[model samples]
Target: MNKYVLSLLCVSSMSFAATPFIYHDFDEAMQIRNYPKAFALTNRILNYDGKQFFELGRSLYNQYNPSVLPSRSEPIIPKHIHQIWIGGPLPEVFKKYIDTWKQMHPDWGYTLWTDENVRELFPLHNQSYYDESEGMGVKSDLLKWEIIYRFGGVYVDVDYECLQPLDELHHLYDFYTAYQPLDAFFVQLGAALYAAHPEHLILKHCIETIQDDWHHKGAPKKSGPCHFSKSFMAVAGENGSRDIAFPSFYFYPLGSKERVLRRSQWVREGAYAIHHWAMSWMPINTRRQEFRTFENERSSKVWND
Candidate 1:
């Protein structure tokens, strides 16, 4: 046997004899997105192979166990709307808006979605199959789904500040999303969608099926992943509904639709809430800026993920 192989065998033998202990250096690990380290720590605790290991880790990390975790139909009927103001690194402006929104909707749930934390929980390499164009690619979508599954509510980009109460749209939608036609003709601005319906299994199945198709495409027949709108349509079909009810403009402003803002004058007419969308913060040119001044403002509060 080779000398290196003999050394490896000895190490393996010793490792087998001694038990593996799982230790998580969460504080240090969070400094940089230490997915590999987190994965290794998880592996030490569970004897599952690489396949089962990842699923187990994700389940634990997201606090998603079908048996233990509360179901959507359980005691929590959600007295107030659960919302998230997600973006890259949170800005000071966000804190101000969160405070104001909380005051307006006292029972609302608020969460911050940061890029660093997402990467740690769901790495791109781990997704079944990924494509770049589907909002954030398949990997990102799966992570988003995980969030919805765990939290059970609506998600809005931080760029979209609240202007009115969201209580009006308590149970109008089955699966909620920021909808826009590929042509940008009929766009639903702002990220307000309902997901508390019992029939959401239809939407869930559609998402899983598309993910399967992407996974099985194989290297020989590479293709762009399915668009999110297409998947949403699939959900609508499964739920036996012609159209998913999107919250009316009262929840969002006309400027929220990125395309409509360029060609139309809805923004000038005084819309309720503006949706910055993808380019929410970045100014296109001096003439076209994404930020809007708010009349009311307040302080901030901290919450753990």
Candidate 2:
């Protein structure tokens, strides 16, 4: 398997009070600008395979059983937001996008995980993957799990713009995630933006899903949103859900009809955040140009099939 290409299995580890850490005035020089160069033809082929969602879902379901997690709900989740960057210095626009996050939620704590200190999050066994893994998308997917399981807060991509304080949404669920599009329903979950309380079973299962498949699969695909949906749906079935899945309007305005950011600065009422669809994980060449079209193909497979 080409370590440079981001595989679909999103995996992670939990060792101690020493899993990865984040927050506080992070580095100004963040590699958060554009994605890197072209991927090998072989790697590209592997990534495209995950478009088969039903097969992936069934495979994941067979591997994992639902967890009867504790009856924990919102407000229990920490008022923290975790974002990660693992490449060259970030673009100036990103700084502004993140700063808006701070301005909107003065009460919430913010953490920016970056390469300068990424090793601080993973364990010894996974360190080799970290060193060898080439795609920032893969690394970011791994980092989000650690942060969610350890810190218990909201996680967003650098491109997400905060419209209002997240207090209303964060204080409602123990392991809540945003859907991709209301029209498609449970077709896909936005892996990049989700919330969880520390130690939630769904998050652990997410970690396990990635770890179990990491050897054969690349992450940010196999281990990302699709993996998360399996864990979430399984757990929701085992234990009645509690404000667990939210509509796209909550955190995914860009993917929905009310693309407020594109038409006008004002979003429809009740929207809290907007993902600008800044696909930093995409290969910087022709593959990136096909980013939206590729993602659209995901709709062909839904949660049921």
Q: For model 1, how does the per-residue alpha-carbon lDDT over 1-305 read when each residue is reduced to its tens digit?
A: 85533543333333222122122221221221323443343234222232232332233323321223333333222333333333334445445445434554566565555555565445333254432322222233444444555455554444454444444333323343332211222212122333443335534553455544443332111221123333443344243332232323322434333345321222222222345443322222311232333211111110100
* Per-model lDDT: 0.35, 0.53
In terms of lDDT, the best-performing candidate is 2
Top-scoring candidate (TM-score): 2
Candidate 2 lands at a TM-score of: 0.64
Weakest lDDT window of 10 consecutive positions for candidate 1: 296-305
In order of listing, the candidates' clash counts read 2, 18
**TM-score of decoy 1:** 0.45
In model 2, the number of clashes is 18
lDDT score for residue 82 of model 1:
37
lDDT of 2 by residue, 1-305 (tens): 63311111111011111111111111111111111221222125433332333333333322321222233354767889898877766655466568767766677898888767767776833455555566666666767877788879989888776655666445445666665642332345678688877878877777766665565553534556656765665454245324345445456656533334441232323345667665656533323232343231221122111
**Candidate 1 error regions (>4 Å):** 1-88, 115-142, 171-173, 176-183, 186-194, 197-199, 202-206, 209-226, 237-243, 247-252, 256-273, 278-305
lDDT of 1: 0.35
